[model samples]
Target: MSPTRSTRALRAVDAPQSTLSAAAGELIDADPLFVRERTAASELPDPAPLVSNLARSVVEVISGVRDIEQLSRWVTDDVYRHLLIRTQHAARARQARRRPTRRPNFVELSVRIQATTENIVDAVVVLDFGARVRAVTVRLEGLDRRWRASAIHVL
Candidate 1:
């Protein structure tokens, strides 16, 4: 058989019918029990303490004093990846400078949290690092019955 003939035969056997039944559409619309439902902001705990702690922990991770894995459970995958990259860069810089890994001397100046929706909150955490001040912005979303950081930015 020619190559084109065999390819066509295989495609015909492997391809599924494009028609979708009403039952399938209904199933798609129905909520599955296996998937966790997002919780409302009101149902979640106050985000101030968590935001402050997370900001501090993030700074520590970037300063080589804390592990990025410790913050994984509280942040989304994208945020975790971003933190991991920052941590690695920080570690390399510290290594290049031959600096000791020590806890950062920082104080939480203030935390401001605002609710944008029923399940979303935006927070800004201010920190005083003795000589410099920094702000960490975190977006918290209620997911799986808890508040998780979906986005974080340090400036």
Candidate 2:
């Protein structure tokens, strides 16, 4: 990110702690299951990539796809080569048989991020299949001033 954008995030993190007049935030904030850090809504970083990439990987796998390269690009290290081998094999087998293997359903998502000083982000995403949890992945990465994904995991 540009220096200006970096400054904006810094200012947000350093805001005075006394101001308390604001309307409700996103609709999800009202849910009993919602837990948030950085008391101010302004502090929440955009999680779309984390959410989207996560959903895409699960959906791609369960759909019996052989296009591991695409999903591999989003992963860190050998998750594509080592960790995901069984999944890829299964997908390829299902495809060869011309039968559907499974479908992806997002079970839950949780993230813990710290936005001041140096940024740290950790994410956990779960995908379900019918009554069973099909996959669970954990991701950890640091953002530069730009807050881009630097590393991702399938753990």
Candidate 3:
């Protein structure tokens, strides 16, 4: 073949190979699982609202509400179990003390987020309940696009 014809043939061959390679790369990048994995690893939702709601729910539970069903929506099974046991014990203690169990009378609540990861967060919540201050540490995890409390420590 003539030099020009040979050059033209080479160019045509290389063009298709380059296009095929680029297409392969694009296909890999567009894979559903790969996209989902990347998004799941990189995406982190704001935790302020979640922490506030969870804190309020915990306070309500401690204040003789005993709404485990509603609390389940925002907490993990372990946390729910913990809350159930603790609330029951507190109720019994109050009965033993001959005092009627009632909701906490709090002036204000202050929430401080300690650490945040892609799917986990640690926070401290303080409630100014009339006579004294109550503080609790809460750890939350993101599951199925919603935040739920994984653990709680009352202080």
By lDDT, the best candidate is 1
Question: How many clashing pairs per prediction, in order?
Answer: 0, 0, 0
After superposing candidate 1 on the true structure, give the runs of residues whose Cα lies further than 4 Å from its correct spot: 1-36
lDDT by residue (tens digit), candidate 1, 1-155? 56798898787666665534454556656857535478999898888889999999999889987888899899998899988988888889989999989999988889999999999999999999999999999999999999999999999
**Root-mean-square deviation per candidate:** 7.8, 17.0, 18.1
For model 1 the local lDDT of residue 72 reads 89
lDDT of each: 0.89, 0.50, 0.75
In model 2, pairs of residues that clash are none
Better of 2 and 3 by lDDT: 3
Q: Model 2's lDDT to the true fold? A: 0.50
Q: Which ten residues in a row have the lowest lDDT in candidate 1?
A: 17-26
- Candidate 2 stretches with Cα past 4 Å from truth are 1-45, 92-99, 105-119, 143-155
